[model samples]
Target chain A: MIDQPARARDFGQSRPHAGENPPFLLTTSSPGRSQRRLAVCVLVVLVGALVVTAPFARIPLENTEALLPAYAAAVFVNEVITASLLLALFSVQRSRAVFALSIGYLFSGVMVIPWALTFPGVFESLGLPDAGLQSTAAIATLRRLGFPIFVLAYALLEDSGSSARVSHGSARSVILAGVAGVVAIACGSTWLIVTSDDALPGFMKDTRNVAAPWQYVPATAVCLYLVGLCVLWIRPRSVLNLWLMVVLCTLLIEIVILSYLSAGLRLSLGWWAGRLYGLLSASLVLLVLLSEKTTLYARLVRSVSAERRAREARLTAMEALSASIAHEVNQPLASMVTNADAGLRWLGRQSPNVDEARAALKRIVDDGHRAAKVIEGITTMFKKGAQERVSVNMNRLIEETLRRCRDEARLGRISVQAELDADLPPVMGSPVQLQQVISNLVANAIDAMTAVAGRKRVICIRSARRNSDAILVSVEDSGTGLDPKYRDRIFEPFFTTRSDGMGMGLMFCQSVIEAHGGRLWVTDNEPHGAIFHFTLPSADDPPSTAGATVR
Target chain B: MVMSDDSLIAVVDDDESAREAVAGLVRSLGFLAAEFGSAADFLASDQRSRTACLIADVRMPGVTGPELYSHLMASGTPIPTVLITAYAREAARDRALKSGIRCYLAKPLDPDELLACIRSAIGDGKGRIE
Candidate 1:
């Protein structure tokens, strides 16, 4: 038993917390150079692989004279350039594992280069008798060295952000499994290599002509099958995992063709598996490259979206500042205007108006006191507003919002109205935030009415019961109908249709409502303008979250 | 500002053009007007004790309309206020009407309708006739 959420853990602790997110928001303009260089390096690897596999299509291992030189040359070139790229990356940043891998890669890249360069003739220079040089030991050395090239490539990938942390497996377990699988595959490959060269296994056959390299076809097929099973066990969803399995299956089928070549003492052509094997390997490498590119593209897209959201919040704050200021300043200003008007009237009247003049003076004095009081109220509110969250009444919230805009509505000749939902329950929320939302809806309605030339300029605001679940308030304006296409996106920040409006209004409204555990939306009222409505969730729900504590 | 019947309303505002305009609009419909220059004099006057509908300007220099409304509201004067402000704030309006404002009007207040709202909030001026 794994004693863990075995299947769930397979997705790991979300994504691996690694340097996968670069240290800084890097805007490196030089990516063009690096990307092109990487692309060229990839092209070189594929070309070298092709050139190396080509000549080997002609001869069996026993006929080494025909193929070794070119194979060595191709391997050497591919390894060297790959090593250079890794080394360049290492020099740019000392990201631990990459540096270590580069050390090994650079060494291997150099050794393979000389080996591929001196190809076919290098086998002749082995200084052993020709037949002895074709011994299984000779072939086994090449197999061991050739296999590590792929292992090294996997190392490079791990260094590039594909940390195994995302897979929930212990590092020790993965390493052990990889090692065991590689050893098993290597042993099977060794059998296929030795048998295909037609060297008889003393225990399996008597008087057998093992000179036929193609005779081991069934054994080679079995070896390829093992490689497929191991890759599938390691990573089911990885493209590399799927491609490696498919390639091995293809190689297994080609092994059947080897049977005929071996039987004809066409030991001269029995090395056919080598050419087929090289092609399948190269194709898998290409698939891995493509999958990596796609993963990079997805991660880039995710970061871009996060950046956009942060930008939008700041924009919304800027757009709603005016309404916020009005809500604060409107109260006292209205009071002063009323007191002044009353006082001014008493100044000119007849009937000696003695009592009336005195009364007006008293109101004037009262207006001054009220104005000072409102200013004090606003000063306290702004200074402490940023300090903490407080519970606010939805009913008073509506009134204050309307009063804030009282002057504006008066100036526009449009009527402002309100009907408080008598039974509305209190909701805990940010007052400023809720104010911003209601103001946006009201302002938009006022703007819409500006274009109309009719006397039906009533803005009916009604607050009503919304069943037992919510408190609903709707602002019904008598402006023209809104465009249908603009419906869903009206709440998208900075995406406004108005030339003078900061597109942030609707979006900010939606955000504020959402923050308060409520919903805000707009609709066309029957026969006329827009009806914007919002609902704040009741504060009576029993806490389902772990952190809730009743006061 | 509103007064229970027999008590006259003095709606003093500065925009004489707007004040008399509003006065004519209100008086033609029926309401009293005792105008003055600033709050300084209104504090020094006699009507402070017995006056009725106080339709004052919110932006007056010495004392604002809301300042007068709050003072009266705080004193438990039993007078209903029909505050008219050009403010677009929810908090302030809510505070003004928490007890029960006849109506919180935004100016330029509709002269005829505001009087009607004031009359309705306190009971038609005739209610005091009983």
Candidate 2:
């Protein structure tokens, strides 16, 4: 019985996951993400060189004093795009990694405006109150420091596969806190720079003071963190993690270049290159994430279609089963009605034929029980409940299944021959499900033989002890043999040869057999036709008995 | 209104218990009953001309009730058939009625309804014979 929720979960389970089925060679690398990372690396290198060469080579391009506004606008656009992309990624899958990354981007995008406003010349020229170069340096330092910290946190969360997600209310609070913190830092730094510009150290006064001892502190700390992150990357993880590590590596190189170019004036080519590298690092993960999102969407579409097809096939199978159920139930009902009438007639005689009436009443009782059993069988077979495994006599179950198919066999001019080992042991399984397996096989055999002319139609069912621990049952039909090409695909769900066939019968049989810790397979019978064989562990087996005993 | 026991009603059904039970009811109604496992068996038997009414299941192995009715009609021996079915298909009932079947009844058949159909079928047969 397949419940809707349970089957939906099964569909989710069918999706391939990295940790679920690990590769034989445990490597944390992905070629696609690696290629994207390489592209990012090349872009960073080209931009880094261009920025570094501009000041020393005395290019026609103006210095930081003139190009400041254009640089600020470019940084603003990059930051905004990065933040939006991160938020989009967070929306798709609310992981700690994405949340942290989004917050980092948001902070950087907001801080860039304040950083540009206080960068000495640009906003001061417009008569806007500027926080001076000290606040500009502080904002730049804070922005650069913010990204790596968030990225490292994201990497840590990725390492812990089941990272905790923030609740809705808490997440909103966290975002509010982050915005307040960024605003506070920006305002506080401006206030300090405005009130005490002369009290600040020489390193904060200008971009050319790279030799200041305080400047090395944040750079060394960032380098140490980057090294630690590199160590984490040495171990195997997902493709996403690997790409993030690559981004971090490039960011580290950009940091080194930024510190080196800090010896030059503001908006020096190296400083601009450093900013470009930062933009590249931020964009790398977003690009990979967007590509992954596309792949996931494609997978989702494929699975949904596959699920729909499976459902359609199941409906078709149910229709066939319902027809069979109607026939099975109706026979006994007709018998019961007839017997009741017979009993009444016998009793209505002038000299009541009591013996005959008693016989008719007995038949009525038997037919009533038969009808009830048929209803019970169908209910149990189709019920959306967990299957209950019990010790079931295989021979008896096969006999009952054959009895159900007797009418079909007769109509098809098919002879059914059952050879049962008298001493065969019972197996543990759902009797109704097992019975369905046999009935489907027998019914299929009967249907297969309908096309045969002149040749004797014979269906042979055999049950024997495969060993002390297992019992084997086989159904063989003397009909058109299975084609070699279709033999492998016969058990695939919805793969059908007949126009009227739903093609789920064999697949259902195989699943039931496998769920019972058994194996079901097909083979070519001698001369003609096909044989389906399944093996069930004997009830005497300790493992199988354990399951039934628990019930 | 009295009918002799020699006036036989043939009950053809794939089910043994149903065939025997219907036969028993016919016997109690002052008619001799002949039971056949299937329509083919009834056709093979020598009781076709003597049978006053034919009560047969709609679905049978070799020949269905309506098919037997048609065969009889084609042979110039139109037996009054009351077709019994487990599945109450309106199309089958319509087809059976159009082919001049006396009645079409679904299974878990009402004994009273069946007896009435059987009596009416016998009356029709007798009228035709006279």
Candidate 3:
């Protein structure tokens, strides 16, 4: 059994976005060319700005120590904000990319404070014991390298389908355990480096003191990572992958500025520019992820309102259906009651007329059965289950439909004509549904002619073999023709010209025809009116047979 | 009540059972009855002149009961008419009354009510003749 309420709630919670865009906002596959162009344009602008500002950036500052707290605060704020946003995204849709990204942010945030404190000038200025330049370089290297590696891992794991294997409950627990483990590692590593600065290699210490020779190692590593990221960026599999490429690109620019162009002293223009770029790179993925979450929430609200409107339409349809049933059943019942009463009057005579009474009694039985048959047709039509299809004679079905609407046609002063081809093959479809289609068409034709003055109120219905595999049916009316603009929209649900019309009649007819593997449409009638046409495939033909040749 | 042999009661209805049943009820009340499948058929017959009290269905093929009554009044032969309907619409009843119909009854009509209506129409015919 399907859990309808739960499914509805899920729609309310995680509704899919409408229109051409997918719920994963940035995962568009076809926009790679444009995105590449945008990347080039941004790269050009950044390079030009750097070249123009290099002369002014060469001047050294009076005190680099004054800027250390501000730089540390900016890094801390960016990393923490990014981490929280990634965590929120992972909670919404548990994925390997989101989990790795969140942990990476947490690591960067935790390591940045220690990196700031252990920097040579900042540490001595704060009057704390100096954890030498080597320790600070190691921590800075780890923090810078952590994000790109995690991002690359996320991009490579796009099609791994790791998220599908984990259940919702297990995924939540895994994320929590991963978060705790990262915190422990970050704190433990920071403490080890701060307490015993000698654990670092002598070469790392020598490189930190000179800063020129050993910088090439990290610079070369960043360039190689940039090349790898560019290759992956060419054909990003998801939104996260694309944004990750942008983050990595910005990180490469920051690394080039800090390790290649900047002087050993603090507060250089290259240093400030590199830090600003790093802050931007850290926030890009989180911004994209958070925006996607907001779009998903907006989609949820739209879907809930759409469902509520659908429910209201269904209730209105039910009311209309009941009214139709009452109208149909009342005629036969009236005859039954009158026949029974007439039968009694005949039998109560002084000289009892037995033969006449028998005739009246027989009519009562017939009328009762007729009413029962009407009820049976209604119940079968509305029955909620798989519909049964069988070979049906189009001519007989049309005749029956006309018979049902004969009284209304006559009362409306409408002359109905039928031209059914005798040699036409039977079509495969549900009899009741097809009957309703014809009945509705005929009724509409009569309604359309109700207001016509000084014109022949005629409704012509015809059925013929359109091809070897299909048969065509048409209902033509000599009434006011539909506007050419509304010709197509007339079949849409809740679209109607009549004030009293429920507007579901044509929509229901179209659906019934479509369900029978056919097509329904309308055209302008000759002279002045409208004609509705539909086609059904022959029973002997396969479902994939060529469509009927009818304009 | 004995209706005059010369006075014919015309029954107009589209349904075979309903038309015959109403005719049978008219005959049971001792009136000479004639049946017409449609208002057009009744209008074409010579029985229109002889009909002292006409019992017709409100809805029928070609010409409805109220329309037939209007046609008769327009032609200056206003016969006393009783309208019977299977579907009871207040608008139709009001239209029939406005057209000067003697009675408008909904089906399964009470036999006594119909009999009383026909008897009074016959009585009025006699009074008008005198």
TM-score of each candidate? 0.33, 0.63, 0.61
TM-score, chain B, each candidate: 0.70, 0.89, 0.91
Instruction: Name the candidate that leads on DockQ.
Output: 2
Which runs of model 3 end up more than 4 angstroms from their true locations? Answer: A1-44, A47-58, A61-85, A113-136, A162-164, A201-217, A220-224, A227-231, A234-236, A263-265, A290-326, A372-551, B6-46, B49-130
A best-first ranking of the candidates according to their DockQ comes to 2, 3, 1
**DockQ of predicted model 2:** 0.37
lDDT of 2 by residue, A1-551 (tens): 12222222111112222243222111223546566566567656655675655455322234455666666676667656766666554432335566776677677767777777777767766888756446666666667777677766666654345333443224445556655776686677667666785676545545444436456645764675576477557645555656666667667656655665444334555656666676676567667666666766787699979988887877877778768987888787777777777788889878888998898888888878888888777645654364877889998898777766654564455667777777899987889889999999988888788899878788888888997888999998899979888988999866778876778899889877877878899999988899999998888888755465322
**Which docking category, incorrect, acceptable, medium or high, applies to candidate 2?**
acceptable
List DockQ, one per candidate, in order.
0.04, 0.37, 0.35
TM-score, structure 2 vs. true: 0.63
- Evaluated at residue A332, the lDDT of candidate 2 is 77
- Model 1 lDDT tens row, A1-551: 12222221111223333443232211111124544454446545544544564444445456544555455455445544444444343333323343343333334333443333223344456663233213333242344244333433443344354442212213334334433554455455544544454553322221113343333534544553565446444632333334434444444433433334343222244444544444444344344444454755687788978877776676676657545566445543444454455555555555335565565456556546755765666545543553344666777777777766654564455666566656677766677777777788888888988887754665766666576756787988888768999888888866888765568788768766765667888888888888999887665544442113211
Best by TM-score: 2
C-alpha local distance difference test of each model: 0.52, 0.70, 0.73
Cα lDDT, model 2, residue A367 = 79
